[model samples]
Target chain A: MKRTNEFAVGLAVLLALTVVVAGALWLSETDLNKQQVTAQARFRTVGGLGVGAPVTLRGVKVGRVEAIRLVANEWVETEFSLDRVVELPPKPAVISASASLFGEWSANIISYDPPPTDPNLREALAESDQVGGDAWPGATLPDIGQLTAQASRIAGDVGVVTQRISQAFDSTALKNMQQSVKDLAEISGRLVEFAGAQTTRIDRVSRNVATTSDAFAGVAQTFQGAVARLDTATSDNQLKDILNNGRASSADLRQAAGDLRSVMTAARENQASLIRVVQQADSLMTKIQRGNGTLGMLASDSTLYRETTATVIQFRELLTDIKANPKKYLKISVF
Target chain B: MSPPVASRIAARDGFVAHIGRRSLETARALADVRTWSPLLMGQMRRLGVDSVPIALFIAVFTGIVLSLLSSYIFTGAVPLYFVGALVGKTVMMELGPVLTGMALAGRVGASIAAELGTMKVTEQVDALETLAYDRNAYLVVPRVLAATLMFPVVTALAMGVGITSGWITAVNLLDLSTPEFFKGLKLFYQFKDIWFGLLKSASFGAAVALMGCLRGLDAKSGAQGVGQSTTRAVVLGCEAILVLDAFWALVLL
Candidate 1:
């Protein structure tokens, strides 16, 4: 064999071996020189996350998941190796989420201080915090496929609701709604008219109130003046002299009241005679009203009124003749 | 005994005797490794090193076609970066080994069978036996050992070229960036995938060389027999490669 062939064959084998080793290390992102720190994360679910999934800090790749195992059939614990130079944020949290729409997943190391903006992510993180251990708190975001399925379900629900709405909103319901609207419009017109009438009445009432308030203010002023006068009367010594005079007048009025009481007693004793006289007068008045006695006949007889009126007129004429004739006969004697 | 029964029993005994002879040859080859050891490097050079160019040629086009095809298939349904994933995975896991093995079967297996068959038909193998030379050690062990040892090296180089070609196609033709292509390439890569492919290629190499040896040693008559053995070696080696590919996928993967 030629030395050149041996060299070529050895070189080819060496080159192939180097490619295999170097390609694996580069693709796996494993550095033999770099020191690594191992950390464990406990999760309720890993979703599409698997071994060799990239671990990122602040969106930059820092490590990869080394192994995953189920613990007590409850939690999925993922052991990962991080570059030792990476300084973990205080209160580090792990959120495993779909890295792309193609079912790729990644673990994002985040700080719990700022918290996640999404309420669901926040709740998941809170639940993970309760999984007490040295392991970092880990939460799994719903995969893109799950989100798509949920959106599809929501669309189905909306479609069903829309179909039901279309079924219920038939011609009859439309007519009923139109009738209600018409009735509402008519009621609104009537209310407007009623309000117009009430508005005038309200204006009148407001004017009356204004007048009453003015009157009440005057009365209040008068009362205030009276109160002031009363206060002055009470303060002055002249009010004491008036009170003394009032006392003396009260005694005189008391004596007069005693006399009045005696008179009332005497009147009480003559009450029967007085009542008999009142009854006789009442009888006379009743006869006159009934036109039954002589006074009643005179009141009722129109011919007697006429005859008396004629006799008075004739007597006036005779008196006039006597005056003239006596003057002529010189009958001016004191007979 | 009936004549048909006698013939059936005779066929069965002949098959068993063939199996016994093949076993003895394999045992002799192993026992006399020193006698065949020197021929191993020359065989490796001819079989593995010389075979690298053709394997790499097949791998490059396989990568380019796979990249373009995956881009077409995953156009809107999946991200463009997944083209890289498809190209990398298919080349490393299946195409790189299987295609390289088939190409080598046509090249190395046919040549081995033709050369050995010509020797057998010309009484060169008989002359060796008459001279008390162990032909299995002198001929079969070295070829099989060289093929087995070198198939992985060639496969590894082909895998590297295949991935590189895919990356170039993605960057140039698919409008994908280097980082984007590499992102998807590393997405699902496992170190064991390389080992699995190498193991399958090694098995294919052994099967192809062994089948060629068996067919060549069994050749009869003259030039026509040599041609027939060469054809059988190429056909049987290809079939063996496909069967081994499936077998490795099931057993290891």
Candidate 2:
């Protein structure tokens, strides 16, 4: 009975221990039988990566970090184990440390397509071959410290730009722009008013031009009618008679003009003789008035003239008698 | 000084001497492992195998509470599945081993101290010494070995139960799926975390058992002494677990 009790207790304890250990192994995700391929990568810094950190392919975990060591006291050599079933390209890009959104860090693998062509990539690939054929050069993300520094620099640049912009928009420049806009608006208003006022004057000028053009058209019509009449008269033989009459009239007029010219010449010749005769007449009239001529004296001596007349009457009687007898006497003397 | 004060000071001195002597005797008992192996197995059955139900109950409820609180606190910024990771990490790294150690300190430590203290006060331990048997090896070593062996098992059990309960609660209440919960649970977990927990639990188990034995061995010949010893064992066992937990964290982590 005592042995049976001891056996039962031993069995129970063994069972409990086994259960506990198995549960722990399960919770810890231990898989001893999983096949792993060892690969190496080198970096300038590991960025706080420790052993047992996950190794992922495109953000999915496939293995863990096995070891890390310094190479030649300069480069960090990180050895990681990956599942053998996960195939890597001939050249793979390894990220030494990548942080998740929650800040957990891990190593990641990215496949290099078309094989890297850069010289640095070739050198890294060659170095990876020295550790293992599956190895590659690892890359690193900018850490929080670097990101914070970059952010601070960006913020400083933004602040400076804002300050410069603020300075550029000074009160004077803004006011000048506003004033220029207002001046343009006023000029536009004046131009509109000028155009409105000129419209009425333009209408009046157009009406006057229309009226003058109508008068000119009427004058042109009248001149055209006269020209038409003249043209019709020239086209007919009616102007020939008038032209002939004009020529005849011109000849007669020339003859008449010649006669009149002769008459005028004769008159001009007789003008001097007429002036002499008139002067003689004027002297006799003057002498007569002064009573110096014989005729003038005869009139003045009318009474004495009567007596002489009586004597002459007596001589006449005597001459009448002598004449009857004097012919015979004078005839004989002349022979 | 008054006479009563002088008496109190003398009493204090004597109690200090008694604790020191008991500690030395317990250290000497560690050398006799062969004689205590069978008793260690029996005690292991009692401490670990038999105590699974209560430990599981406490762990499950603790996990539920941790999940509830984490979801409530981190709901806005953190994803819902992170509650699983939070609960798993907390239970495995700190709570699982420490809480289990404390629970056992109350249950197993008080029981051991009360049994041994009653024996001491009744002169049963003296009778065993007079019979030419090694009382320390027969009595205290088994309890210490059993507790040390069982602590890792119990801690592992608690961790598994607690993490599972947290996963269940997150799935049911926080709208998290099973796969997402599991993904978050294993996001940053490591085998070293389990090892650290086991190591601390082993130390805590040994401390709890040793303190109980020492207190019982130093008990006076009265019912009051037995009761006082039991109380002191539970209190000192819990204190020792906390101190050792901090020490291991400092050294390992």
Best by DockQ: 1
Off by over 4 Å in 2: A1-32, A48-52, A69-72, A112-134, A152-335, B1-21
Summing lDDT over every window of 10 consecutive residues in candidate 1 chain B, give the lowest-scoring window. Answer: B15-24
What DockQ would candidate 1 receive versus the native complex?
A: 0.49
Please give the CA lDDT of all the candidate structures: 0.89, 0.81
Error of 1 at B183 (Å): 1.4
lDDT of candidate 1 over B1-253, digit per residue (tens): 9999999999979955874687578667778877787788899999999999999999999889999999989887888988877887898899999999999999989989998999999999999889887899988888988898888999999999999999999999987999899988988888877888889899999888887887898889899999999998899899889988888888987
Error of 1 at B168 (Å): 1.8
Best-matching candidate per TM-score: 1
* Residue B232 miss distance in model 1 (angstroms): 0.9
State iRMS for model 2.
3.0
TM-score of the second chain, cand. 1: 0.92
Q: Write the per-residue lDDT of candidate 2 for residues A1-335, one digit (tens) a residue.
A: 44654675676556656756775566555557877778888876777677767888877888878788998747788888888898776577676554655656788887655534666645554455455543476656666766789999999999999999889989998999899999999999999999999999999999999999999999999999999998898789668878989999999999999999999999999998999999999897777777768866765667668889998998898788788888754655445
